[model samples]
Target: MPRRGNRLLVVGLVGAAALTSAMAVAALATGAEPVAAGVVCPNPVDELPAIPAGARIQVERELSALDQQVAEANERLVSTAGQGGPNFAQNAILGPLRDKRAATLERIAIAIGREADRPEGLEQFATCALLGEGEQPAPTTTTTARETTSTTAAPEQEQDDVAARIACPDPTGALPAVPQAARAEVERELANLDRQVEEANERLVSTRGQGGPNFVDNAILGPLESKRAAALDRIEIAIGRVSDQRPGGLESFAECSLG
Candidate 1:
């Protein structure tokens, strides 16, 4: 083992290194120009909360929704881009919102990836188990006999609803071609929406029935509220992407909003 003084030196070095790396990452992500290496950020100690091993399933759930959102929207995005549009004003509104939505989903995926780097996060993937209230890991259910059942039957209803929602566009009518700028905006908006939904769902599941500290930190309560606030911020950003002179008839930027 290292001597006391050596251990203190090592601990300080590790903390400094972690803070420096985090600063670089945040700067790059935000597109901020780097300051001198000696310049410290205001909150050097800030760190993402450590995801528990028990939280792996929650992380996975967020990831799955995020991936599905992006996958489902990809074709629709291309279709929107290829079709003729009423122009950037009407078209601009929808495309960007869609793009932001996708980005939101992507963010959830990214967060999950980060969470997975933790010790508990990695172990959870090895089996079908749950972390009990006391941090003890065990098989998911109480009864041993019930554990044999598989749970993959829920997709039929989902698929049916999707098929119903997207009726084929008019055979005779030519859709407007989506401008390149509009399509780019659409993609960005979709990503944003994905993040918003992911955070929301994560909160809902986490906060279900807990109280006190859990209530304060879990998504079911506080996290959902935070996600809601984030969604509003994203919405404002999406709206600002549109021209101010947009015609008066629109109720929303979504496709379903077009009269």
Candidate 2:
């Protein structure tokens, strides 16, 4: 009876050891690590200025591209581990990544510039760092309710002082039937008019709280009206070139209002 008990205990010990080995293998196969290690890149988009609606699509695409660049760099870092010298990661991986990030950031800035003020010094966000073993990315700060209210109060007040966006009449809808010869030019001008409104609205949103009560009128709307008027004039000319009956009073639709 004692010998049988000892045999059972031996079998139990072996089973426990086998389970432990299986778990370790499973962890490796699943890429499950208690702590992550490799390169950690700062997300530049997190610091980006508010994107205007006109530029939102391009800006988002560039942001996604930046993420892809970081992922590829990290994969390279892991795959080439222990194969290169100490500076290999820096020269072969990190430096090129920084350049790619800088170029992508420039594209984002340009896209934003088409609608609102372009941000400066975006190249500063291009650098990345290698994280040692067991290290984690820095955590973002969390503000308490009281702190959040205090910090946001001024901005809210400023927003109240400014208009949210601008509204403009769509002159294209008011246009008469177009000739084939003038359709392309007229359509181009119509598109330009739409772009003008979009840019003005974006400017209004981005420049809230700046200037005086008449800021929207003196700055955004006035300039936008002038641009719209010019585009409308071109549309009228385009139609007149192909047809005797040209669209009249197009310039009247150029003036925009703030909401």
Off by over 4 Å in 2: 1-34, 135-259
Alpha carbon lDDT of each predicted model: 0.32, 0.62
Q: What is the lDDT, from 0 to 100, of the residue 166 in candidate 1? A: 13
Runs with alpha carbons beyond 4 Å of true place in candidate 1: 1-183, 206-209, 212-222, 238-242, 245-259
Backbone clash total, candidate 2: 0
lDDT of 2 by residue, 131-159 (tens): 55654333322113223443466766657
Residues 12-123 of candidate 1: C-alpha lDDT, one tens digit per residue: 1112322343344344434455443221111111121333433434543543443343334333444455466445322543344345444543443355466355322222
- How far out, in Å, is residue 87 in model 1? 72
Q: TM-scores of the models, in the given order?
A: 0.21, 0.41
**What clash count does candidate 1 reach?**
40
> Lowest lDDT 10-mer window, candidate 1?
5-14
